[model samples]
Target: MTSAPPHQSILDKPFVLDLFAGPGGLDVAGHRLGIPSLGLEWDRSACLTRYAAGLDTLHADVSAIRRESFESLPPEINVLAGGPPCQTYSVAGTGTGREALEEVKKFIERLMAGDSDEEIDKELRKLSDPRTALVLEPLRYAIQATRSPNRGHRPYDVIVLEQVPAVEALWVRYAEVLQKVGLPDGTRYEVVVDVLATETYGVPQTRSRAVLIARREGLGTPSLPEPTHRAYEAKEWNRRNGDSAAPVAQPTLCDASVPGPSPAADDDLEHWTSMGDALAEPVGTQHRGRRTPFLVRSNYGSSGIPGRRGVRTDRQPATTVTGRISRFVVFEHLDDDIVYEGARFSMNEAGMLQSFPPDYPWSGTAKAQQVGNAVPPLFGAHLLSAALGLPAPAPEVMREPWIPATEEQRAKLRSHGCGTADDCTARCPRPEDQTPPRSTSRPRRNTASRQ
Candidate 1:
């Protein structure tokens, strides 16, 4: 898919500095849209992956790194984008939104009080949860950049940030502060905040993220990008009720790697790509002679946590691709028999689900961690498009007449049950004799807890 030539705007588009640049998702988006970018990451694994992918990167902690250290920084930085580490404010995390929100408020209040940096530092040190306070670092950089005389009169044109939805209140609070006080240059920042579903941006996953875009007064107000694809949950609710109103669903795991889509794939109606398509490898028929391209037996169950109950191709997008993606089980169906082959989706598949290049240079021991933590490049593209005011649209969902794809299709995609998830729950017995259970019950029944 070709993009329009880079838009000629007020600012001479230079490199965007991506803080917390895990595995270059935003950088990939920037590079594709013709905007150069530099990533600042401290993790050894992420840094190695960035350099191996040949993407520009700086291996340093964003808290300590200053823009002046980069001799290559353009006269004007076009964009400042970053997603601060969000473990402290995630659902899977300790559920510390309230505590973090309070801490963030204190920081804002201290800043408003004109408390000295030493005082702010002392206050931050008082928090038992340190990561909670790290969110304020972006504001520090923004304030400093706006006030710096290094770039003559040009202040940073745009600032973008992302975090888990639980942190929306905190971000909105920061936005309030930035809005109330203009930059040192007397230019106020126009702020737009929203929570976006990654699937809507064509990432092949249901990951939802809260985004905040703030631009200093002058370059005009910025708005969040419009949803390009219908969210799967939204489509399912509509389909269940037979409320069919021209559905434009997000590309499913199936569409992510469907090397070649039929030219007439979406002629009459838009169809959501299925799990089978995303897992189909070019070395064989898209489904390896399976009756349909929608059934999959995954190691995970469909019930509790996502990816635990295996995912079926036609159901919903694969559960949020998390750091522990290895827990998923891959099943192979041969003719009339279903075989538990103990296969897992390749790292390439994980990358595709996250919307990275198929051949992205992957390094480091925590490869799965990098993949899980990244913002999908496709989603990042839409965000960049909004920042620069460009049009980034999702592709048409491949239309298929096979309405209500088979029950087996849904079963394979559905989480839990159906013998797809083997040894899934930790409560499943492990005999000292190493003998298989003689009862022959469904391998997916024993559920205690996931490790």
Candidate 2:
């Protein structure tokens, strides 16, 4: 896969149609790249948030929408993107999607065999969980674009899909089917699929997702985005500490004397973005004068141990942000003593950690779930740039504050009782007047037995 020439714009006047779009993550990225995007989502809350953010949206189910529905749109939809609902495939949920994998593969095979949509839908109705069938919606859309006469016999120039890591096998099957799809001019799609670590793309969290990118061979090749930052590695002391060992605390941001772990050998890549780096700044009046050296305790256990909970210092990348993020607790720490109990991360902070603009307007119900489920806009930008063979966006683009594009959008936000576009007030706890007791002794090094 050779890179497109610098002078040529592969995505000139491109338009993206995103399925299962949640709160406009990829849409935000598209906006940053000067590309137009429209999202098709059924969730009312998500749709409300999308409208408030000034993104074009089709409030409908992915399965119900067909190619003909988009023919009336002003822009030609050449880019197909989606991140399907992954509840059934998630390890934290029921393993129904994993069990139904074989059936899903069989469905894909039938689709490849030119089976009618009615026949496929009839079989899909028999599944115990209907959501499992939604994963194949992207493939169905691709088939419609390529085979439908109403679309001028033109296939989507690009297709990108993301899901939980367990869905990598399904993406592989998608790659196979996409490669077999031949265009009128004897061209097919070039495909690539892999599990990408969020931190590797500069997201201040340790989350992984299976991603697939396919481009028409006639246009150019498709490739996964290269990592722009090093993967986060827990300090050796933290990693080796067992449940029986004393909890290990990271050095505070104020303590410059204690050095951090060495940088990666690759000088080209930047160090992984840490939770401290993301939250160090005050967002409006909230999170002001926060106590240094805080620890985040996970609500879930590690390695099936009942009492063993995972913990991380602000200096490290955060654990996977999930729908249950409200349950995670943050506490101010001074070596071994808990100095002050702090509030959990606010919706704004959670969105920031997921690489959304700190002040991006978020509305409707289950706001935490919306932020947790979104693809980090920065990560999406890089992925889209790579998939389109365009130059990666500048680093500063992620930090820029989002502004309403028109007076209508501003009016909508005001009607919804939202604050100024720059308002990023989080619900983080403020530091109290009482001072924490100072430690008389030096902090002990980790010398506990690994066994």
Candidate 3:
């Protein structure tokens, strides 16, 4: 395993303090980058996974933790990175996006006005929101850490945060506040926030997150890193940003594991990896010289939410793999000897799609929850690289490009007995298992697919 560059002591290296550190995503990436780090998390299942992964962690709620309680620093640099709990600010939450933004503003205004916890709590309770205020905890620590040592402070030299896209408003507001907290020498924080896609940084699946990066006044600067792989075609106006991501297509699910012609022989190959690549196994149907990719969570349930076709092929990058991925169905191709074809993704396969090591040594009863909640470690490395203004090397999990199986090899497999489509419906939680087609009258729940 690669370690951090030559630093005299752990103290000489800027340590990363990860808050709300679900499953050590940032911490694991920090280690890969040779950076020393520790995580602060409250979930027992996630904490167990962290210990299993050999990551340093403190199992406690951020709301109750104190930066002053940490060990004394050696007067070098340090980093504060985390994704505060954001369910209340997510589209999945009961609170409206506008309401969440207002709540954040109120929290800051109250903090600036020196309000008591009880007073703040009373107003938050009136808003019927409790978790919305947690975003402030990191700010509290950032301010505390960057204070002058004469004030007994352990001010962090950098701050990195992430949340759902809806919380971008909250993060922008935060930069406005964090810039004010300074050391005794009047060195203020430098901050930047951007919405970044995981795929743009080379993760197989596509997931967009709002990222915030900051540094001490003297640090060079805070800027989001340039994309490594290509992003899906940008909108008509987004083209002006000039990110200049690779002209090559974004990696597909197959890049992680697939049997195909060597790409070196042809320069115009698709870069996107496929689920089959990550799973490192064949689920395709056999017919003549062709083998069709396997389908997971494809439309084959008794019922489900509409517009969620869940019909991606093993040859394509899997859609955002979520925490509930365990419950999704796999529509096995109707090959010879398999009349009622179907299967579910093993926890390992799902985790791999999320860019985790194959044998992560997961230690949690809620395995799916742990996998879904944490950031993909590869993507986490990208985030850290952006904050540190360095390159995030591609993960070593990728195998060499392959040559497609010859016809003789393909003939050994079962034949595809049925046509291409799987007519069955998926099972949804609602009483009626049937998902009705979208009506022209009722508008879409969202304008764009949250790709």
Candidate 4:
């Protein structure tokens, strides 16, 4: 692990308070950068996974943590980081947050107007999904840290936040508000907000997230991280033949006919990582002998096309992993027949695809959801490095594998006397009998033959 250089800021040490910290993704990234982090999360399943990974955590709702309590927190805490709950803002979900965007802005205005917490909480309760209000909780903490006399009115040196791409507008609003916040010392936040594609940061999946980074004036202006990998171009596979109604078949790793996205004209960045590149050497003992050149078929339809399933070859980066990841099927071509490869991605494999350590201890139920929702630790490290004005972690450092939890860490969980079935020591259990669903559409030739 690499330690951050001594900062020139007022704080002697840097500690992090991560809100809505799901499964310690950003915390793990901070740890790699030699920064200690404490996370607040509400889900028991996520908390179990966090404990198993040996992350410091308070398994409580963000809303319940009063602003006054911020004063009592560790004084060295100078960094605020979080990825608030995004279900309502996700395009795949109900869109409650998207619909309530204007209303949420009004709440921000109220907060700016110095409305009492009780007044804001009362109004937030009436939203369709109360979770939508959680998005503003970071701003609340930021306000408390910078303006509340109870906290000595010391502004956090850095604030980093992330959410689904749909929340970019809200993050922009945050940037605007944060830049105007003046502290007692004549310092204000310098803010940057943008949508980041995870694959461009070397994560082996194509996931887009809205990110906001703020740093107090004089520390440095925060900026988005530069890409370390070529962006995945879906257009490479969308080339059409004249008069052909159907699109061309996806290319495989061995298919030399189709070239990848052209590299940037000015900078050198590695080609996008393929699923095979990440999973070529299986992580755990159970999957050590599995063969490669497999294909993954999504259980859900693509582009809202009925019966049109999405498929990706091992040579390509995976589509975004989601809570319903268990519904994806992994299979290989055996002569003319399709053979299932372990039914689907194991929990560890899914984590690996998301750039987690191979032996990262994921515990408890909804394990797939936990992995899906996590910030890819690799991406997190780059983002944090950018926000903190530190050197980017070397590619080899990011790729170095290790067991996330030590035997002592496991013992610590046992000492807590947690009797739940999803015990911390045990590997995250797979979904019950996750057999691949039979395809309803007419079977086409296997992806291997498409080349």
TM per model? Answer: 0.72, 0.83, 0.69, 0.82
lDDT of 3 at 141: 65
RMSD of each: 14.0, 11.4, 14.3, 8.4
Instruction: Give the Cα-based TM-score of candidate 2 against the true structure.
Output: 0.83
Alpha-carbon deviation at 78 in model 4, angstroms: 0.7
Off by over 4 Å in 3: 1-12, 67-77, 96-98, 109-127, 147-154, 180-187, 233-270, 281-292, 298-308, 334-341, 397-451
lDDT of 3 at 326: 83
- Summarize candidate 1's per-residue lDDT along 154-256 as a digit string, tens digits: 5567888998898788778877877886554455678889898877666666688999987766666778887655565644533443331221122123321
Off by over 4 Å in 1: 1-10, 67-75, 112-114, 234-273, 281-310, 337-342, 393-451
TM-score pick, better of 1 and 2: 2
Which ten residues in a row are the worst by lDDT in model 1?
396-405
Residue 265 local lDDT, model 1: 48
Candidate with better TM-score, 2 vs 3: 2
- The count of residue-pair clashes in candidate 2 stands at 0
- Full-model lDDT, candidate 3: 0.59
Off by over 4 Å in 2: 1-3, 6-8, 67-75, 147-150, 181-187, 235-260, 283-291, 334-338, 404-407, 410-451
- Sort every candidate by TM-score, greatest first: 2, 4, 1, 3
Residue-wise lDDT of candidate 4 within 264-314, one digit each (tens)? Answer: 788699898888888777555434523556667664336676655666667
